[model samples]
Target: METPSTSTSSYQRDDGPVRATLVGIGLTVFGLLMANVLTTPAFLFDPALLEGLGNGSIAGRTLALILNFVGMFLAGLLYLLATGRGLAWIDLRIPSRRDWKYIVAGGVGSLVFLFAFNIVTTLLEVSAAESQIMEIIGGDQTMILIMIVVVFLFNAPAEEFLFRNVIQKRLYAAFTRMQAVVVASVIFALVHFPMYVAFADSLLSTLASLTVMFGGALIFGYVYAKTDNLLVPTAAHAVLNAFQFTVLYLAIEYGIEEVQAEPATLAEVADAVWTVAVALA
Candidate 1:
């Protein structure tokens, strides 16, 4: 009888409990909560935390940017420590040349799908998802820029490594592809609960985010299954995030401010409904 080749098998057969990754995610969440807590004003009489601190000067914006970097770095570190993996994973140096090609293609394709889906859903109106998204994001271009940078460059990489490459990969070793996607997607969505609560009033935006995020998880998981490599999904995630951020910047740059109409178009309403139907299906 021929022995099973270890090389053809998944790495890390021990497949330890995703404790480390979960810990890392937890610590990062805690750090964010702390950041928000510390920044809050001491009293009602005082102005809001981090409000107008830089006087709209370059120094102020630069300081804000620096702080954001610090936050991301700390959160990433905590996540790594909890997961028992060194920071090397975030560099994502394992993917092969073929992996890169697939990642790029998959990422771009997913972005296109998301963008088109949003446009259609917004037109259909079954969900008020788009406006809610804008509200949670807040109307601060500087802050939004900082967020985009952190998410794409720092948070996204670390998260993909932990969630997809590390945790999901291990899980898939014991489950089917669909099961892996479902588990990974649930975890991914849970991580964003804070953001959802922070923008509770934006029902449409919240729904939109839920759909986008879960859909992203499913796509990334599928990529991993196809390639058996973390690099593909990580790169794909980064591309999608960067693309979305770019679109947002373009909209803002073009002076597309808040929504003008009280009730969205019937088309948008219908799209929202269909998006939900598709997601549910």
Candidate 2:
């Protein structure tokens, strides 16, 4: 369970859980604030831009997604610099062949977890909150492809860097490894509550969705702890997202007729799938 933080002599003393929690919260807020400040002008000024930036439009959603990545990244970078650590401390090095095993295991584990959780939710009649969010971000084929690329390249890496590399590592110094994992995972799950709130119909369903996300975050944190390679968890996160998106794409392309009496357009289906994946991730 030794991380680069554990191995390095130059690492700073743990700031304790309270400070870590405060810093993590601060970073999240700062990122959101920055995104709002940066995107609001463009969102307001241009008519065509306004249309593109509509809630369900590809351009609008993509802009939001990119702003999220930028905000988290800048915040993480500032945190590291303030703490006297550099980018190297985050361990962005490419995973080795052995590390790849953990990455693959994480991906497989996520799929298994999601499958089991979905079955249980289905039995209990709990809806997937992400699906509703997807319906709001309607897009066409070109937009879908662009969304996939952005998600795979920017969103996955930026999120892993912020959560696993920075937040989890800092928390690890203040708590037992298991405690750190639980706490970090809780934060991770909680951060997603806004999306769930926007789309979930009932409290129980929202709780169920968060519970599944918490489980996934636990797996991600564990893999990062074990391997000490950010890429391992990032790969896993990307794979999980890719799998989910692929399934949605296939469902939209092939099963739409079977599922709906008058099927939605392929673009609409793609939009729904992409938006859901974005929210869930």
Candidate 3:
């Protein structure tokens, strides 16, 4: 119901957006680098010791997911320490009833945005990066289950802690709430672009994927701002991601492939643009 205590005796009010931006950007870059190194198939497994752990294998995916989770958490913790803040600043407590409302709103908002984005992209003949991600999910039911758990428990919290709690909160000291929200959301969306680029066959598809991400990040930022609870946004994020993976799992199980979009007529493209504008409004 109330905002968490962000106060600290060691916290410096003068350390504003400049410090926040540097620390946020630095930790993100560092975390990605560490994740890549830690998840490298050659580094994690010896060819002779683990001949079956190829880059595309379930073992590799699991390892990479786990390592990436660890790397992000470590990076966040380090950022907190470096900034003279503590875990208390992150507001990782149980959500209050009001917080739950915000969480549900955030989750539903995300789903709505997702459906709208999907419709627009489908009309525009944009292929989804999710197809490639689903391929990585593969047909292994057990691995898929494990992935859902990891994403819900680890990835969601870790990302929310870093972006919303640390980065956005710090940015608040230097900018208006809306400005902080936009900047933080932009960073959040931009960081995910590499994955889309890796999977998308064309730049247009990658941009479309990033557009959806940006919209989702905007909603997440808005929720955190409104509720002032990290757990709310984190829970919402977890729910959204888990639901997505769940749908993917069911699709894979039932052999329902992603729908390929037909080439858009000029009118369809204009209509799709109008729809997006209306949705944004």
Candidate 4:
């Protein structure tokens, strides 16, 4: 019998594994420093000072959002510095033609999966169908348009690069694909812990949020697997966030001002299921 070929696969680069380990360490350090920096301002600075500008004013909210966004970005930069990689290795470059095609497909797939999952949960007595964050924002068409543009340009893309592209990709080199995804997903969910506490409004809701996000890591991972391009996954991530933001905005503006007061119930759950089934059909 002929000896089996043992030639290494071309996808296995010389530096991938070593670089991945160092990057993971750097990311952990970066996250710690970022938390410290953000929390410090709260102690020395007056909470009222920010509140005075406007309680949940658009500009105030925007500033807070920017700070959170940039803080994570700085963390990612720290990782790059530690790993001796530049911005390019972080997968921050603009998407190419091929990247855009796969990105659209991934985006569509993300929406489809999101809808399906919601449907399943609804049938299981989980929730009613409701608009997501972006849907709410979109009701104010002018503001929504601007927010979408900003998100598409910066907020969405930046987060994707930091969490998924740079960090997740590097981790993949060290761990099995599934292991890498779990690590990445855990980090992704932890960073948004506050959101789960504030918006999710219940233990079950929080767990659901965890499931959605980790599943997101898998979807993004699928995009990367197909294209070997970060842009595709990044775009998908952006679309998902923007969509959620819009939905939440609309929900608040139109009805159900307080999530804590009125929880998603059995009827809502059925709505969610029906919506997904129809969409899939």
Cα RMSD (Å) per model? 8.2, 6.0, 6.8, 7.4
Tens digits of per-residue lDDT, candidate 4, 177-225, equal 5566667767776655565555555666666666666677677876665
lDDT of 1 by residue, 203-264 (tens): 66566657767777888877776666656776787766555454455445555433222112
> Which is the winner by TM-score between candidate 2 and candidate 3?
2
Each candidate structure's TM-score, on Cα atoms with residue i matched to residue i, is 0.61, 0.81, 0.80, 0.68
In model 1, the runs with Cα more than 4 Å from the true position are 1-8, 11-91, 128-148, 197-205, 228-230, 258-281
| lDDT per model vs. reference | 0.54, 0.67, 0.67, 0.56
TM-score of 1: 0.61
Better of 1 and 4 by TM-score: 4
> Tens-digit lDDT track for model 3 on 162-251?
788877877777677677788888888789788778767889877876787788788899888876788888889888777655544454
Q: Which 10 residues in a row give candidate 1 its minimum summed lDDT?
A: 258-267
